[model samples]
Target: MTVQTSFESRSPATGEFLARHRVDSSVAVDAAVRRARVAADWWAGLGFTDRRRRLLRWKHVLVRELDGIAELMHQETGKPVDDARLELVLAVDHLDWAAKHAGQVLGLRRVPSGLLGFNLAASVRYLPFGVVGVIGPWNYPVFTPMGSIGYALAAGNAVVFKPSEFATGVGVRLVETFAEAVHEQPALQAVTGFGDTGAALCRSAVDKIGFTGSTATGKRVMAACAQSLTPVLIEAGGKDAAIVAADADLGAAAEAIAFGAMGNAGQTCVGIERAYVVDAVFDRFIERVAAIADRIRVGAEPQAQLGPITMPAQVSVIRRHIEDAIARGGRAVVGGPESVRPPFVHPVVLVDVPEDSEAITEETFGPVLVVNRVRTLDEAVDRANSSRYGLGSAVFAGRRTATALAHRLHAGMTSVNGVQSFATVPSLPFGGTRESGFGRIHGADGLREFARPQAIARQRFRSPANLLSFARTARDMRVPMLLTRSLHKRG
Candidate 1:
């Protein structure tokens, strides 16, 4: 049976439904992909410069209408308008960078041919994957999904986007703008529905799928994509950690930990869910962070520093983590289960939590963070890498030592002394390995993700091995084969 987008999307701050629509069926998904194929051909045929021009025009729309878009995002998400703009600002910057750099990074390049193929010329080029399916999350809806959509378009692939059911209005607006930028075809289209719509995309004949959601859902998506041997990139959930060393900048650490933990009401996949503070600064650091958390308020009002929890199901997850930690000998240094006030979830600063507690080891996916004291940097690193997730991390230490510690963490990207800044830097690749998901989604790696590598070789002449063809060449084979073995062997 097919599902409908009948569920109401409510504002987290006010608990009011925003908008709703009907879900797309397998039939609709197939039609979308078919349309995308034709669009892909047109999008691909355009020179990189022309494609970039179109993208820039689309970006201009976003810039000119920034205030309107930001307000819509804020009303729909319950996040402050300022915070909503943060998502757009970083997103526009990435769009700009991708447009300017796609040709230089993704154009054809020469491949070296060994001496064995001296008479042949070889080169490699990136070919579009035809159509790509992007299943995006509701948090930072525009910025997150655009990471896949924009890059796929720049790489010459048409995108069929299935945004989170909760953000169908935003998704529709995005597609409307995309159509405006390219009047000839539907380069980007939306299929608004629930998991069934996403599953339909997974089962369809699309060339690749890019998904961003929880780890459990990611596993299911991977299994579904495996049925078609379709490549997938899953920017799944994370239990990202921040390490506060004795030599760290305490003020900066406090700011990073607080925002990394509480931003988007802690709805982000790469948000900081755990913190390891050096025993030396544990007391003072905790006090400073707690003060910051206390000043924060969660409501629909524009003055609040933070907002209410966006996903209703996430409320239960946050409660479970806090209760589990408290039952497992952990204490809530600041806020606890009582902090979750339905529509508006206040920031919870958990301290004295066990390193193995669910609060520390699991993804609360809320405005909650667990702070544990460690004696050494070794202990901090060990605790940070203990979880099954390894998406993103942060290290607050000396420049040299921070880089060293970041390398040791089992994550894809690390911010040396900042929070969420790595995701803003389009120059670096994004995404994770292991349970966090495989593959990348930003930078040159992102452009290549929606494309397949094609290698071409041109032969100038026949090889010496042709001498052994119909003639009496037993002796010739012996000489050539012997020479091949001798040349291959290390003296």
Candidate 2:
């Protein structure tokens, strides 16, 4: 008899074994994709109206069991209950929006055929890719992956989700809830395992893959998908920054920066990893941030404001970055390297960090913030844009200054006066540029991302000025040139 293989998922808070999940082999992943393909046809036939209604039902199911799912998220990810609840709330909101807005966003729309093709009618519609494979991260297990899964399903595709091994239970629960919503189709499923499982999903016969994880892992996922000539969308790592202008609201800025940098132990892809403050308010900003950080509790307690570093290995990375920053003329105003206490890392605020140091350059997915002072807002913008990863950023300034500074950053999403709140707004597209990865996963753009656009042009009536037919004469082409010159030449 062949022995069954599996892996253990342990709690990051106590290092206790939580559950055992099968390690999905290449064969298993291929089977899941094949099942999805079979279900995709039935799902697509449901049409926009029916699919929209069914998806709203799915959203209702998600809302009904939100508490239970949040608990699972807390157990698997070691996040506080409140934090898990907040993540679930945002995820449910996205699902509702995706379902409600799918028809208007992806339905066929008439397009102008132009004067040159006046005899033709043109329109375009988005078609689903049949099947989508999603590789989710553990940090924001439900919210992050659902950004792809919810929109893809709304766009008429079956999804096979592969959750991070550390958070397999949460992924399974989400799939089960979806299954309950649309049981006749069974179009949604989960495959749980480690790196090999994710790689297998990428290589499977899915039409596209939506991946959320580290930049290194995203490259690997993209490479695997490339083997099959499959299209992929990646939401990778980030070293996002928060820029505080001299004219910014100090109290509000300090609160936003502290929460943005320390929430979920700073494991968010769009978390405020660095801060650039104008020289005039640098000292005052640090003082306010430190005061705020000192009051935030970090532990596994129910009331704790911050939680453990879900990935065990990240503690060391956080320690290394903090030490490197301190060694290179940086001062720790709040916590320090010693703050990395096993699973729970308290907040750490480092001031005057060098630009070239690892703490400023690398993605330390822990509750650590590095603040630097700049002579001018332009210098701060220049320094923020210097990073290789440009996922998300925050700008706190006067209305005009904030808008101007936001335009200068290279990030995909910039929250003016807030920190990453754009993520909660379902109408805005979210993703990154540069090393942070490509493609979007929210709003109308996200619905279209899981689909392919096909354009149709039909001849409404037979015209003497036919241009696309072999019967067209050279005189027909001359007419267009003459019209172009008359309409556009130096006019």
Candidate 3:
């Protein structure tokens, strides 16, 4: 008998074994996709009203079991309970939004067919792509993956989720709970394992793929999907930065920047890895940031402000970035070399780092921040936009200045006075540009992302000219030229 392969999930906080999950082979992934195909047809046939009802029930189930799911998230991802709860709450809110707004966002609507089609009635609608494959990340597993899953399901497609290996237990719980709301239909299912399983999901028969991971891995996922001509949505890494103007609120900027950098142990893709403050206020901002960093307690305890790194190997990476900054003449304003202790990395605040240093250019997926001073707000914007990442950014300034500066940012989402506030509003689309990856998840655009636009036209009347029949009409050809000349002749 062939033995089945399995992997174990251990708490990064204490290295305690949490749960075991079977490694799904490519054959298993194919089977799941097939099941999803059947479920997609049934779900889509139910129409928007019935599907919305089912999804709302699923949302209710999630809300009722939020505590249990949050606990599993804490154990599997090594995040504090409150952090887990916060993430879960956001995920559930997205679920509710997606379910309630999907129909209106994607339903068929009358559209202008232009002057050439005056005799025809035209409409357009978003149609499901059948089955969608999702490759989730370990950090914020609940919130991140649901950004794709909830929207995809609301758009009338079945989902085959492949959660990160470290968060397999949490993935399983989510699938089970969703199953209760959608009994007997394989509308939502999870395939567990390591990278191989995720690779399998990419190559499965799903109609589209929603991937969240490093940029390097995202390229591989895209390549795999290319084999079958399947469409894909990639949500990758970011070296997000925050800009603090001379006229900005230094205290609020410090508090927001510190939380943006240290929250979730800095595993977020849109977290503030770098901060550029105006020279006039840089000193005060640094002082406030350091004080806030000092107050953060890194542990698995309830009172701790931040938790351990979910990935053990990331510890060395964090250490390397910090050391590289210091070796290159950067000064540690708060924690430094001693900050990285195994799975937990105490927040490290560095300043005077070179703009070209790895600390500024790279995505340090750890609780570390590098603050740099610029002579003016223009200089701050230039330095902030210099990185290859264009994910999420924050600008702290007066309303007009902040708005003006925000427009100049290269990132996909920019907050005027807060950090990551755009992510909380379900109406705004979230994603990035450049190496951070393409495509979006959230709101109306998110629902449309999982679907394809289909146009419909009905002949309400026949044109006297019979222009489309090609019945050798000289006027048919001359009429368009005359109309074009009259309508678009340098008006």
Candidate 4:
């Protein structure tokens, strides 16, 4: 295949051109990784304190240019400015949390010496993995990738980011802003291009790759990384569900489900794609959700609650899912297939969608929701967990029931009485399980994801019963055998 040399980004809301970016070749990607390796050594040598200071400086720089950065995000992704700003705010908050907590999370700590090695002292510390390659998605160009970039940098690893072609401008601007803060070295850099550019990064010598995109693209990334035996952290597609129990606050559940499913034109990875409401309250819940979803305006205007679909190809996918649901005896309570306009899809609330339909089974990543009625709360939980993609989920019920239902959901993260709330808390680990992809990108687990743990052992003094010594005779081992038997024989 002929690799495209360069690509131009245009506003998704309009056909207007935004900016053009050079597609980095394999050689360019290698050079960038080589630079990152050198920078990683220096960055790691800075220790936790210095790295924290530098990362905080970068956060400050991001805050200073918040408006400009958000504007660029809006132009490229066609998301509302306020939503763009909120994305930045979450990214910045994760950065601050990662910077401030890296030491405590990855710092050296003493470990207990087992009974078999009573004379030995042991300690463990998580050390950086030199370099990390990040492939970001356009839907959340800033916040989603920052979940990896910020935590990796905090853990003392140099990062070479490969952002989505649709959001090239925002990616480049992010790297440029980082240079402004950490001028001493290229610890954080971005390579812009299409799929081939990202593939090049995956095949490069980076210690690990952090990828966030569709499940299909994530599989491609894993395949490329497999050639080099490099590790990967994937945050892929999610057909997340929301369970509304009979006791749930119908108004609150409706509002959250509407916003969760339709926000950002329904481009969110962890957004609600399916909803299961108990049969007793299904009618009332559907009525409220349809009402709210109908009032949500979609446009490029500042006052609009939702913006245009950032990716042009997704418009057809959205239309297909809606049509499939309707064909399978589902009713469009709010908007029908006709609501799908190029670069814009109105909120679609589907009721009685077949369990096997595309809208319920696949990741219908548009402003569409499949709401189904369940005979009981247990049935709701079972239906919710039936999807192959279990990234995130929500449970709307009373405190006791919500907690119970949340725990029953087979997902990496779950929010009780709220939607997408797990993502806003910087201290919580993010990512998904099963086909939604593995590995975390926030909190302590996020820091450790970019680093390797090193265990150290030192002999405080020699023991007379040295079990590891070859010079010991059979009689010398008798005491240890008896002690071991006495200690563990009961268990």
Candidate 5:
């Protein structure tokens, strides 16, 4: 007889295992994809108006059960209830927005046939890609994954979600709510397991995959996806930086950095991992941040300002970051390497860390920040852009700070005077350009990612230059070049 052991999931607030079930070793994720494939036709046939109505009702269910949903997330991840509420609220808004905007964004729109091709009428419409597979992270599980799931569903593609093992309960509850709204249809299905389950989802016959996790895991996921030639959107981890100018509001900057860095025990991918302040105001900014961070407290209760580290494996990563920082002549004014108090790791503030140090070079993914001083904004931008990870960034500058620094930072999303505020606005596209991964997860970009544009051009009448027929001649291409040169030539 063979006995299989299980991986136990525990609550970060309390050292108690929450669930211990045998892992699902099924390699049949293709069936889940097929179910979704069938569901896609039914879902898309709803046309945008009916889809909007259904999704609206779904959003209502989410709003009605917001408290319960938040509690489940809080209990599973050990994040504050308020924080969970924050994420769910955004997700709710996105569902409503996506449902309403899908028709307009994905609807067929006519394209102009240039003067040379006047005989042809052309148009393009975004068509659903059948099925999309989403592998979500534990931190901000709702908001992050919904960016893809909600949009994919709205665009008429069926979604199969694989939530993080640690947050599977939360995923189940969300899916249960959707089932209540949509009846017993597998429009959205949740598969629970460890990395194997996730890899299966990737290897399974899905049109596209959207993954959010660490960089190393992201590469592995990409490799797996490559096996099936599956297109993927990887919202990998980031080492985001916040720059504080000398003329900025020191108090607000400090508080923003503190909350942005320490929120959710710093298990955030876009969290403020580093802070670069001008030498003229570095000392003042450091003082303000240290004071604010020290005042913040972590507790097991739901009302606590901060909570515990959700993933147990991350505890070691956090410790190593702090220890490495301290060992390399970095000073921790507020908290240090021994800050681990069981499930919760208290906030730590480091200063005077070399830009080339391990703490600055690697992603800590904890409630910690590495502060450095630069002589000029040029130096600040250089240091911020030095890292391989450029997922997100923030700048505290004068009136032109956001506009000017926007061009300097190499990341996809950057917020001025706020930390990660770009993510809240539904108009902007989220997801990074570099190691953060490609493909967008919000706004128009989100809608397009799950769609394939089928370009159709019908000839109203036989063109004088028939490019597709044997009668066509190479001379047909000369008209376009001549027109282009005539319109803009110096002569």
Candidate 6:
């Protein structure tokens, strides 16, 4: 296939041309990696304190230009300015946490040499992987990619980011701001294009690749990286669910679930896609959720609560899911198939949907919710855990019961009595298992994800036995054998 040399970025809401970006070819991608490798050496040479200082300076720049960056994000992604600001706030917070904690998390640490190797001193430290190629998603142009970009930079690796074609402008802006903050080198750079460009990046010489997108696309990335046996950290699609137990606070649960499903036009990967409510309170809970869904406003107006679907292709998927649910005998309590308008889908609440239906099984990636009635909390947990994607989940119940229920769900992160709250905590690791993709992008795990653990051993003194030398005798073996028996023998 002939790769396009350039692409246009247009507003999802109005189709207004935003900017044109040059597509980086495989050769251009390789050049970027080479530059990043050079920058990585300089970045890694700076000790933890100096690196921290530079990162903090970049953070402050982001803070000062928050409004401008959020505006750009709004134009590029069709999200409300306020929502864009929230994304920036969370991204900045993660950046701060990663920068401030990288040393404590990845710094050198001593380990006991053990009895047999007492004369040797051993230590381990996480070293930067040189360069990392990041493939960001358009759904969250800033926040999602920053989760990887920020932590990778903190861990001392230079980054070459490939922002989704739909959000290329935002990505370019980010790289420009980083240059403004750290003018000495191109430690953070962006290469823009479509799937070919991302594939080019995956096949590059970067030590690692961090990707966030659909599971199908993630698989493609893995395949490309496999050519070079390069490592990858994938944050893929999610069909997250929320479980509402009998003892839950119905109003709070309803509000959170509604927002979780409808927010971002339901473009969020970890957003609530399914809700399983116990039979005892199923009717009341559905009514409450329907009420909240009815109040949600989705449009380009300033008063609107949700913005247009950033990617136009997703609109059909949302409509199809709603149509499939209704065709499968599901009832739409809030908005039905007619509620789906190109570029904007009003909140939809589907009930009585069959568990095997596409609406319940696949990721709709729109402002739609499927609520099902379960006979018991155990059944609710079982049904929720049956999905292939296990990215995030929520449990709404009494404190003690919620904690127990949260632990039972098969997901990477669970928010008890809340929705998508685990991502707000900077110290908590974020990522999912199974089809949702592997590896983490936040907290200590995120720092280590972009680095390599290097072990060091030094000979403090020579052992009298000289067990490793050719001069060692049978008597030396006998002494070690006797010592092992005395130290390790037990009842």
Question: How many clashing pairs in candidate 4?
Answer: 0
Q: What is the lDDT of residue 53 in candidate 6?
A: 91
Tens digit of per-residue lDDT, candidate 6, span 156-249: 9999999998888889988988998899989999998888889999988999999999999999999998999999999999999999999999
Each prediction's Cα lDDT score?
Answer: 0.87, 0.92, 0.92, 0.93, 0.86, 0.93
lDDT, candidate 1, 167-204, per-residue tens: 77778788888778778888888987899999999998
Residue 144 alpha-carbon offset, candidate 6, angstroms? 0.9
lDDT of 4 at 53: 94
By TM-score, how accurate is candidate 1? Answer: 0.95
Q: Write the residue-wise lDDT of candidate 3 on 1-491 in tens digits.
A: 97569988888888898888899999999999998999999988988899999999999999999999999999888888988999989999999999999999999999997887888999999999999999999998899999999999999999999999989998889999999999969899999888888889888889999999999999999999999999999999999989998889899999999999999999999899999998899999999999999999989887888888888888888999999999999999899999988878999999999988889998999999999989988888899899998999999998989999999999999988899999999989999999989999999999999999999999899865567785848876786778889999894
Q: Write the per-residue lDDT of candidate 4 for residues 1-491, one digit (tens) a residue.
A: 98688888999888789888998998999999999999999999999999999899999999999999999999999999999999999999999999999999999999998987788999999999999999999999999999999999999999999999999899889999889989888999998788888999999999999999999999999999999889999999999999998898999999999989999889999999999999899999988999999899888888988889888889989999999999989999898998998878989899998999999989989999889999999999899999999899999999999998888999999999899999999889999998999999998899999999999999999987856777888887988899889999985
User: Positional deviation of 308 in candidate 3, in angstroms?
Assistant: 0.9
Clashing pairs in 2: none
Relative to the unseen true structure, what is the C-alpha lDDT of residue 109 in candidate 4, on a scale of 0 to 100? Answer: 96
- Which scores higher on TM-score, 4 or 6? 4
Could you give candidate 2's per-residue lDDT for residues 1-491 as a string of tens digits? 98457988888887788889998898999999899999999999898888988888988998899899888888889898888989989998999899889989999999999988798899999999999999999999999999999999999999999999889999999998988889897689998788988988888899999999999999999888888899999999999999999999999999999999999889999999999999999999999999999999887778888878898888899999999999999999998988989988999999989999999899999889999999999899999999999999999999999999999999999999999899999999999999999999999999999999999999899766767789889887888889999999984
Q: After superposition, how far is residue 351 of candidate 6 from its true place, in Å?
A: 0.7
Per-model TM-score on C-alpha atoms? 0.95, 0.98, 0.98, 0.99, 0.96, 0.97
Candidate 1, position 74, lDDT: 87
